[model samples]
Target: MNDRKPNLRSVRELTPALEFCTIHGYRRAYRVAGSGPALLLIHGIGDNSTTWSTVQSQLAQRFTVVAPDLLGHGQSDKPRADYSVAAYANGMRDLLGVLDIEKVTVVGHSLGGGVAMQFAYQFPQLVDRLILIGAGGVTKDVNIALRVASLPMGGEALSLLRLPLVLPSVQAIGAVAGKLLGTTALGRDLPNALRILRDLPEPTATSAFTRTLRAVVDWRGQVVTMLDRCYLTESVPVQLIWGERDAVIPVSHARMAHAAMPGSQLEIFERSGHFPFHDDPDRFVEVVQRFIDSTEPAEYDQTALRQLLRTGVRERAISGTVDTKVAVLDAMGTDERSAT
Candidate 1:
């Protein structure tokens, strides 16, 4: 029941109509348009909700689209806080509560996909449908460049990229180097380093990015995996989308995740890369529309959740206690000594 009005604009508009909300002392900014069942769009690391620019309006025709700039990125306030997936999930829940929107069809890209999965895990009742695009939480095999950036020494190196004073000079040099090298991987090591450099010039954004990246990634590729817990979403409708030409996180992850969850749907964009939604916005929107139209929203059981929690207790009872194990060992020792 927040009386404050939300700032909104259509995709057809030139200047963006961004909205702001103060949630628990943090200034959270988001954009909302159209109306129907609520839809939450989450952006990836180092990127904001602007990444959803291509498809947001088109989808808004049928659904109420709520795309927020995650805390520590874009217009949102960046504070020294826990940047873990669980923390983000809780934040999303709180944001929705503040807006008074109960249920949503959650759509996330890359790092946002990890957050979306964690949200569903933490608050299954709030999630109606789940969609992941080029998600990072399904596999261990991430690009080596990202893994390297997760190291302790990587922070010092990354700081140079955030020097706003020197960015113009760097861009000038980069432009000169680019013409000679063309669009090559070495020209821009990560999938979107050049874009990140341009978009996220603030020191706070850089710091948040570094902290966020290290939490889920390490020198050994991605440290977080949703493969083990994907079964929990069995009752909920899940969709996996990936670019066939994706070099950042590889389409293999989508395949693996799709295989792990037999009930989920998989769509591969043949001519797309890391950002498939951008590669073919119309097709992406069409696919999402079709999926939403075809599937029914999830109806989770509260009793099943309690049952799932109680399983460990039953398992422990079957396995016996620490005292029982010690007692058995003592009895074996007694029998052996007596026989000897």
Candidate 2:
């Protein structure tokens, strides 16, 4: 595996130029390349489309890759309308519709992963395959930092990032920490995390980040989960990728999601952190290409989906599962204590 970290400058140079479109009267920025099947890439919270810069070119060679900056992140307009996962899904749909693209293999990372799942749930007709990398919305377990940031004062706290010297101090600390814990997940992901922090200094970006984070996370952990609807993905090709040492979202969520979603594939990167694609772009690209080549694009069947929803998930399909039960209960405004 190539352990070389991505050079942002070079990656940006190789990626397609940013394109703009108006969705719901807000300007949305995205990049597109190649011309085969479509691939829609969504970046996580506090991240832009540039997160996929390393693999975008390679993926674009074989597929029409489209990477968009969510409304609250990157170059997109950070309107205070809505930052919910479902809202982001709607934004993606509108963006794709404007691009004249009918369907795509949706790839999402971290918070983007939650949006991707929401996309699949809200607009099943648009997704050909689902690829989630260290995705959120798996379980309540998340990095404590996120949990804390989701608190009410989190937005106010972010204002401190904009104070003089604070950003530089954080960067310096991250540099030192990177060298000290070079082999750990935090060390490996510090650069990307720093990049995200730099974006937070901006008030609009900070507000967007806070709202987005609070939508799927809280003082406890992640507030949203996809396990209850994992069974509904039975007709779509699903792939879960995670870093074994991911400090943001635990890799155990991958196993639980894999169990809940029948026939889904999971790939764990041994030496990676939160950004598996960045940690090993070569393998990430290979894995994605191989998965696409091996599996058939999902054919949306309204009848089948209706029947499945009406009949509900089979007991055998999700039997012997604790995660599903917890998710079901959580969805119904209850906790594990009441569930048990």
lDDT values, one for every candidate: 0.77, 0.86
Top-TM-score structure, candidate number: 2
Q: What is the lDDT of residue 6 in candidate 1?
A: 58
Stretches of candidate 1 above 4 Å error?
1-16, 162-166, 169-192, 306-340
> Which residue pairs clash in candidate 2?
none
Off by over 4 Å in 2: 1-14, 319-340
**Over the stretch 98-120, how does candidate 2's per-residue lDDT look in tens digits?**
98999999999999998899999
Q: Candidate 2 — what's its lDDT?
A: 0.86
TM-score of each: 0.81, 0.91
List model 1 lDDT by residue over 1-340, tens digit each.
Answer: 8775455544454233589999889999988877788899999888888888898888887788899999888889999887887788898999999889999999989999989999998999999999999997765678787888889987677678655567777777767775665434333333344566676556788788888888888887777777655556767898999988777787777766665553799899987777889879999999999999999999879887667555522212211245533432332233121110
**Residue 21's lDDT in candidate 1:** 92
